[model samples]
Target: MKKQLSKIIKLILLTCLIFTSMITQPATADIASGAKIFEIHCAGCHENGGNIVRRGKTLKKKALKKYGMDSLEAISAIVTNGKNNMSAYKDRLTTEQIQDVSAYVLEQAEKDWR
Candidate 1:
Protein backbone atom coordinates (compact mmCIF):
# COMPACT_ATOMS: atom_id res chain seq x y z
CA MET A 1 0.00 0.00 0.00
CA LYS A 2 2.84 2.44 0.82
CA LYS A 3 4.63 1.76 -2.45
CA GLN A 4 1.42 2.24 -4.41
CA LEU A 5 0.75 5.61 -2.75
CA SER A 6 4.26 6.83 -3.46
CA LYS A 7 3.96 5.86 -7.11
CA ILE A 8 0.61 7.60 -7.37
CA ILE A 9 2.01 10.82 -5.91
CA LYS A 10 4.92 10.80 -8.33
CA LEU A 11 2.60 10.21 -11.24
CA ILE A 12 0.39 13.09 -10.21
CA LEU A 13 3.36 15.42 -9.89
CA LEU A 14 4.66 14.39 -13.26
CA THR A 15 1.28 14.97 -14.84
CA CYS A 16 1.05 18.41 -13.30
CA LEU A 17 4.50 19.31 -14.55
CA ILE A 18 3.66 18.23 -18.06
CA PHE A 19 0.47 20.20 -18.03
CA THR A 20 2.21 23.29 -16.74
CA SER A 21 4.87 23.02 -19.36
CA MET A 22 2.28 22.72 -22.06
CA ILE A 23 0.57 25.85 -20.85
CA THR A 24 3.72 27.96 -20.52
CA GLN A 25 5.93 26.52 -23.23
CA PRO A 26 5.13 29.06 -25.95
CA ALA A 27 5.87 32.12 -23.84
CA THR A 28 9.05 30.52 -22.56
CA ALA A 29 10.12 29.67 -26.07
CA ASP A 30 9.45 33.22 -27.24
CA ILE A 31 11.43 34.73 -24.40
CA ALA A 32 14.35 32.36 -24.97
CA SER A 33 14.31 33.00 -28.69
CA GLY A 34 14.16 36.75 -28.13
CA ALA A 35 17.05 36.54 -25.70
CA LYS A 36 19.13 34.83 -28.34
CA ILE A 37 18.23 37.48 -30.90
CA PHE A 38 19.05 40.29 -28.48
CA GLU A 39 22.38 38.73 -27.62
CA ILE A 40 23.45 38.46 -31.24
CA HIS A 41 22.23 41.85 -32.41
CA CYS A 42 21.27 44.30 -29.67
CA ALA A 43 23.44 43.36 -26.69
CA GLY A 44 26.46 45.46 -27.66
CA CYS A 45 24.71 48.80 -27.53
CA HIS A 46 21.92 47.98 -25.09
CA GLU A 47 23.61 45.69 -22.66
CA ASN A 48 21.29 44.98 -19.74
CA GLY A 49 18.86 47.50 -21.29
CA GLY A 50 21.36 50.31 -20.82
CA ASN A 51 22.35 52.28 -23.89
CA ILE A 52 26.03 53.11 -24.08
CA VAL A 53 25.98 55.73 -26.82
CA ARG A 54 22.62 57.30 -26.11
CA ARG A 55 22.20 57.29 -22.39
CA GLY A 56 18.90 59.13 -22.48
CA LYS A 57 17.50 56.70 -25.00
CA THR A 58 18.09 53.63 -22.95
CA LEU A 59 15.71 50.67 -23.15
CA LYS A 60 14.35 51.20 -19.68
CA LYS A 61 10.64 51.72 -19.22
CA LYS A 62 11.00 55.35 -18.26
CA ALA A 63 13.22 56.29 -21.18
CA LEU A 64 11.08 54.36 -23.59
CA LYS A 65 7.93 56.01 -22.34
CA LYS A 66 9.54 59.42 -22.43
CA TYR A 67 10.53 58.97 -26.06
CA GLY A 68 7.07 57.62 -26.95
CA MET A 69 8.52 54.23 -27.70
CA ASP A 70 6.84 52.08 -25.12
CA SER A 71 4.89 49.86 -27.47
CA LEU A 72 6.17 46.92 -29.49
CA GLU A 73 5.28 48.67 -32.74
CA ALA A 74 7.19 51.76 -31.74
CA ILE A 75 10.26 49.77 -30.80
CA SER A 76 10.06 47.74 -33.97
CA ALA A 77 9.86 50.90 -36.07
CA ILE A 78 12.91 52.37 -34.43
CA VAL A 79 14.79 49.14 -34.86
CA THR A 80 13.81 48.85 -38.43
CA ASN A 81 14.54 52.44 -39.42
CA GLY A 82 17.30 53.24 -36.95
CA LYS A 83 17.14 56.62 -35.24
CA ASN A 84 19.99 58.97 -34.32
CA ASN A 85 23.11 56.93 -33.46
CA MET A 86 21.27 53.64 -33.93
CA SER A 87 21.84 51.92 -37.27
CA ALA A 88 19.07 50.49 -39.36
CA TYR A 89 18.47 46.77 -39.03
CA LYS A 90 15.77 46.51 -41.66
CA ASP A 91 18.11 45.15 -44.26
CA ARG A 92 19.96 42.85 -41.94
CA LEU A 93 17.24 41.28 -39.80
CA THR A 94 14.07 39.65 -40.98
CA THR A 95 10.69 40.99 -39.97
CA GLU A 96 10.12 38.08 -37.65
CA GLN A 97 13.45 38.65 -35.94
CA ILE A 98 12.68 42.32 -35.41
CA GLN A 99 9.35 41.40 -33.89
CA ASP A 100 11.00 38.84 -31.64
CA VAL A 101 13.58 41.33 -30.44
CA SER A 102 10.87 43.87 -29.81
CA ALA A 103 8.99 41.40 -27.68
CA TYR A 104 12.15 40.53 -25.79
CA VAL A 105 12.90 44.18 -25.12
CA LEU A 106 9.39 44.84 -23.83
CA GLU A 107 9.58 41.83 -21.54
CA GLN A 108 12.96 42.87 -20.20
CA ALA A 109 11.78 46.42 -19.74
CA GLU A 110 8.81 45.21 -17.69
CA LYS A 111 11.16 43.21 -15.49
CA ASP A 112 13.53 46.20 -15.33
CA TRP A 113 16.25 44.04 -16.87
CA ARG A 114 16.68 42.08 -13.68
Candidate 2:
Protein backbone atom coordinates (compact mmCIF):
# COMPACT_ATOMS: atom_id res chain seq x y z
CA MET A 1 0.00 0.00 0.00
CA LYS A 2 2.85 2.42 0.80
CA LYS A 3 4.53 1.71 -2.54
CA GLN A 4 1.26 2.34 -4.41
CA LEU A 5 0.81 5.64 -2.57
CA SER A 6 4.36 6.69 -3.41
CA LYS A 7 3.80 5.95 -7.10
CA ILE A 8 0.59 7.93 -7.11
CA ILE A 9 2.28 10.86 -5.40
CA LYS A 10 5.07 10.85 -7.99
CA LEU A 11 2.52 10.75 -10.82
CA ILE A 12 0.65 13.66 -9.31
CA LEU A 13 3.83 15.70 -8.98
CA LEU A 14 4.79 14.95 -12.56
CA THR A 15 1.35 15.95 -13.80
CA CYS A 16 1.53 19.17 -11.85
CA LEU A 17 4.92 19.97 -13.30
CA ILE A 18 3.67 19.41 -16.83
CA PHE A 19 0.60 21.52 -16.25
CA THR A 20 2.66 24.32 -14.71
CA SER A 21 5.08 24.33 -17.59
CA MET A 22 2.28 24.56 -20.12
CA ILE A 23 0.48 27.29 -18.23
CA THR A 24 3.62 29.36 -17.75
CA GLN A 25 4.81 29.09 -21.32
CA PRO A 26 4.51 32.33 -23.28
CA ALA A 27 2.58 32.54 -26.50
CA THR A 28 4.79 33.61 -29.44
CA ALA A 29 3.61 35.39 -32.57
CA ASP A 30 4.70 34.19 -36.00
CA ILE A 31 7.02 36.93 -37.28
CA ALA A 32 7.65 35.29 -40.64
CA SER A 33 4.01 35.43 -41.63
CA GLY A 34 3.97 39.01 -40.39
CA ALA A 35 6.87 39.90 -42.64
CA LYS A 36 5.10 38.42 -45.62
CA ILE A 37 1.91 40.27 -44.82
CA PHE A 38 3.76 43.51 -44.36
CA GLU A 39 5.60 43.05 -47.60
CA ILE A 40 2.42 42.49 -49.51
CA HIS A 41 0.14 45.01 -47.87
CA CYS A 42 2.21 47.61 -46.02
CA ALA A 43 5.51 47.87 -47.80
CA GLY A 44 4.14 50.21 -50.41
CA CYS A 45 3.39 52.86 -47.80
CA HIS A 46 5.59 51.77 -44.94
CA GLU A 47 8.72 50.39 -46.54
CA ASN A 48 11.49 49.88 -44.02
CA GLY A 49 9.17 51.23 -41.33
CA GLY A 50 9.03 54.68 -42.86
CA ASN A 51 5.58 56.11 -43.41
CA ILE A 52 5.22 57.59 -46.85
CA VAL A 53 1.79 59.05 -46.40
CA ARG A 54 2.41 60.41 -42.94
CA ARG A 55 6.02 61.20 -42.33
CA GLY A 56 5.59 61.92 -38.63
CA LYS A 57 3.72 58.68 -38.01
CA THR A 58 6.39 56.20 -39.00
CA LEU A 59 6.75 52.80 -37.36
CA LYS A 60 10.22 53.51 -36.05
CA LYS A 61 10.93 53.22 -32.34
CA LYS A 62 10.95 56.93 -31.68
CA ALA A 63 7.71 57.53 -33.56
CA LEU A 64 6.02 54.57 -31.91
CA LYS A 65 7.06 55.71 -28.45
CA LYS A 66 6.15 59.32 -29.12
CA TYR A 67 2.75 58.32 -30.45
CA GLY A 68 2.00 55.93 -27.58
CA MET A 69 2.11 52.96 -29.89
CA ASP A 70 5.09 51.13 -28.50
CA SER A 71 3.16 48.24 -27.03
CA LEU A 72 1.80 45.23 -28.90
CA GLU A 73 -1.74 46.04 -27.82
CA ALA A 74 -1.60 49.57 -29.22
CA ILE A 75 -0.02 48.49 -32.46
CA SER A 76 -2.46 45.61 -32.86
CA ALA A 77 -5.41 47.87 -32.25
CA ILE A 78 -4.28 50.42 -34.80
CA VAL A 79 -3.55 47.76 -37.37
CA THR A 80 -6.91 46.13 -36.76
CA ASN A 81 -9.03 49.25 -36.69
CA GLY A 82 -6.94 51.79 -38.62
CA LYS A 83 -6.42 55.45 -37.78
CA ASN A 84 -6.66 58.64 -39.76
CA ASN A 85 -5.29 57.88 -43.22
CA MET A 86 -4.57 54.25 -42.47
CA SER A 87 -7.07 51.79 -43.81
CA ALA A 88 -8.64 49.22 -41.51
CA TYR A 89 -7.39 45.68 -42.00
CA LYS A 90 -10.07 43.85 -40.04
CA ASP A 91 -11.75 42.64 -43.18
CA ARG A 92 -8.47 41.72 -44.87
CA LEU A 93 -6.63 39.98 -42.05
CA THR A 94 -7.44 37.52 -39.32
CA THR A 95 -6.85 38.22 -35.63
CA GLU A 96 -3.89 35.87 -35.65
CA GLN A 97 -2.45 37.61 -38.68
CA ILE A 98 -2.92 41.00 -37.09
CA GLN A 99 -1.19 39.76 -33.96
CA ASP A 100 1.68 38.36 -35.97
CA VAL A 101 2.00 41.58 -37.93
CA SER A 102 1.86 43.70 -34.81
CA ALA A 103 4.57 41.61 -33.19
CA TYR A 104 6.64 41.88 -36.31
CA VAL A 105 6.21 45.65 -36.40
CA LEU A 106 7.30 45.95 -32.79
CA GLU A 107 10.28 43.71 -33.38
CA GLN A 108 11.28 45.75 -36.40
CA ALA A 109 10.78 49.02 -34.60
CA GLU A 110 12.98 47.76 -31.80
CA LYS A 111 15.62 46.92 -34.35
CA ASP A 112 15.23 50.39 -35.92
CA TRP A 113 14.04 48.67 -39.05
CA ARG A 114 17.53 47.50 -39.92
Candidate 3:
Protein backbone atom coordinates (compact mmCIF):
# COMPACT_ATOMS: atom_id res chain seq x y z
CA MET A 1 0.00 0.00 0.00
CA LYS A 2 2.82 2.44 0.86
CA LYS A 3 4.66 1.80 -2.44
CA GLN A 4 1.44 2.26 -4.42
CA LEU A 5 0.67 5.59 -2.71
CA SER A 6 4.25 6.84 -3.38
CA LYS A 7 4.00 5.90 -7.04
CA ILE A 8 0.71 7.72 -7.40
CA ILE A 9 2.16 10.84 -5.76
CA LYS A 10 5.13 10.80 -8.11
CA LEU A 11 2.88 10.49 -11.13
CA ILE A 12 0.77 13.37 -9.99
CA LEU A 13 3.81 15.55 -9.37
CA LEU A 14 5.26 14.76 -12.80
CA THR A 15 1.96 15.54 -14.46
CA CYS A 16 1.75 18.84 -12.66
CA LEU A 17 5.29 19.76 -13.75
CA ILE A 18 4.47 19.05 -17.39
CA PHE A 19 1.27 21.03 -17.20
CA THR A 20 3.04 23.99 -15.61
CA SER A 21 5.73 24.06 -18.27
CA MET A 22 3.19 23.93 -21.07
CA ILE A 23 1.11 26.74 -19.61
CA THR A 24 4.16 28.89 -18.82
CA GLN A 25 5.60 28.67 -22.32
CA PRO A 26 5.57 31.97 -24.14
CA ALA A 27 3.26 32.39 -27.14
CA THR A 28 4.95 32.99 -30.50
CA ALA A 29 3.37 35.47 -32.90
CA ASP A 30 3.52 35.14 -36.68
CA ILE A 31 5.99 37.85 -37.65
CA ALA A 32 5.92 37.32 -41.42
CA SER A 33 2.17 37.52 -41.66
CA GLY A 34 2.35 40.52 -39.37
CA ALA A 35 4.73 42.27 -41.79
CA LYS A 36 2.38 41.65 -44.67
CA ILE A 37 -0.58 42.92 -42.69
CA PHE A 38 1.34 46.05 -41.69
CA GLU A 39 2.21 46.75 -45.28
CA ILE A 40 -1.34 46.40 -46.44
CA HIS A 41 -2.96 48.32 -43.58
CA CYS A 42 -0.46 50.54 -41.78
CA ALA A 43 2.25 51.40 -44.28
CA GLY A 44 0.47 54.41 -45.72
CA CYS A 45 1.19 56.43 -42.61
CA HIS A 46 3.77 54.34 -40.79
CA GLU A 47 6.20 53.35 -43.49
CA ASN A 48 9.43 52.00 -41.99
CA GLY A 49 7.96 52.63 -38.55
CA GLY A 50 7.87 56.35 -39.15
CA ASN A 51 4.52 57.89 -38.40
CA ILE A 52 3.80 60.43 -41.12
CA VAL A 53 0.56 61.57 -39.58
CA ARG A 54 2.14 62.09 -36.18
CA ARG A 55 5.89 62.33 -36.48
CA GLY A 56 6.43 62.33 -32.75
CA LYS A 57 4.39 59.17 -32.38
CA THR A 58 6.51 56.98 -34.62
CA LEU A 59 6.87 53.24 -34.04
CA LYS A 60 10.59 53.46 -33.44
CA LYS A 61 11.85 52.15 -30.12
CA LYS A 62 12.41 55.52 -28.50
CA ALA A 63 9.09 56.95 -29.57
CA LEU A 64 7.22 53.83 -28.55
CA LYS A 65 8.89 53.84 -25.15
CA LYS A 66 8.23 57.52 -24.67
CA TYR A 67 4.57 57.12 -25.52
CA GLY A 68 4.25 54.00 -23.35
CA MET A 69 3.46 51.86 -26.43
CA ASP A 70 6.50 49.62 -26.21
CA SER A 71 4.96 46.31 -25.18
CA LEU A 72 3.00 43.81 -27.28
CA GLU A 73 -0.02 44.26 -25.03
CA ALA A 74 0.07 48.05 -25.36
CA ILE A 75 0.38 47.94 -29.14
CA SER A 76 -2.27 45.25 -29.39
CA ALA A 77 -4.68 47.30 -27.35
CA ILE A 78 -4.18 50.34 -29.56
CA VAL A 79 -4.63 48.29 -32.71
CA THR A 80 -7.76 46.70 -31.33
CA ASN A 81 -9.34 49.80 -29.79
CA GLY A 82 -7.73 52.66 -31.75
CA LYS A 83 -6.51 55.93 -30.25
CA ASN A 84 -6.80 59.41 -31.65
CA ASN A 85 -6.30 59.36 -35.44
CA MET A 86 -5.48 55.68 -35.55
CA SER A 87 -8.36 53.52 -36.68
CA ALA A 88 -9.33 50.39 -34.76
CA TYR A 89 -8.59 47.16 -36.60
CA LYS A 90 -10.76 44.95 -34.39
CA ASP A 91 -13.54 45.10 -36.96
CA ARG A 92 -11.22 44.42 -39.87
CA LEU A 93 -8.61 41.99 -38.54
CA THR A 94 -8.83 38.86 -36.45
CA THR A 95 -7.38 38.72 -32.93
CA GLU A 96 -4.48 36.54 -34.01
CA GLN A 97 -3.64 38.96 -36.78
CA ILE A 98 -3.64 41.80 -34.29
CA GLN A 99 -1.28 39.92 -31.96
CA ASP A 100 1.03 39.10 -34.84
CA VAL A 101 1.14 42.70 -35.97
CA SER A 102 1.79 43.88 -32.44
CA ALA A 103 4.68 41.48 -32.13
CA TYR A 104 6.03 42.62 -35.49
CA VAL A 105 5.82 46.25 -34.45
CA LEU A 106 7.72 45.58 -31.23
CA GLU A 107 10.37 43.58 -33.07
CA GLN A 108 10.81 46.30 -35.64
CA ALA A 109 10.92 48.96 -33.02
CA GLU A 110 13.61 47.06 -31.13
CA LYS A 111 15.62 46.89 -34.33
CA ASP A 112 15.05 50.59 -34.83
CA TRP A 113 13.29 49.66 -38.09
CA ARG A 114 16.68 48.90 -39.60
Overall lDDT per candidate, in order of appearance: 0.89, 0.94, 0.94
lDDT value, candidate 2, whole model: 0.94
Task: Arrange candidates by TM-score, descending.
Answer: 3, 2, 1
Candidate 1, residues 4-114, lDDT tens digits: the string is 999999999999999999985533226677889899999999999999997788999999899999988899899999988999999998887888889899999999999
TM-score of each: 0.73, 0.77, 0.79
1-114: candidate 2 lDDT, tens digit per residue: 999999999999999999999986536899999999999989999999999999999999999999999998899899999999999999999999998999999999999999
Of the two candidates 1 and 2, the one with more favorable lDDT, higher being better, is 2
Candidate 3: where are CA atoms >4 Å away? 1-26
For model 1, what is the error of residue 14's alpha carbon versus the real structure, in angstroms, after optimal superposition? 42
Put down candidate 3 lDDT per residue, 1-114, tens digits, no spaces.
999999999999999999999986647899999999999999999999998888899999999999899988899999999999999999999999999999999999988898
Residue 87 CA error for candidate 1 (Å)? 0.8
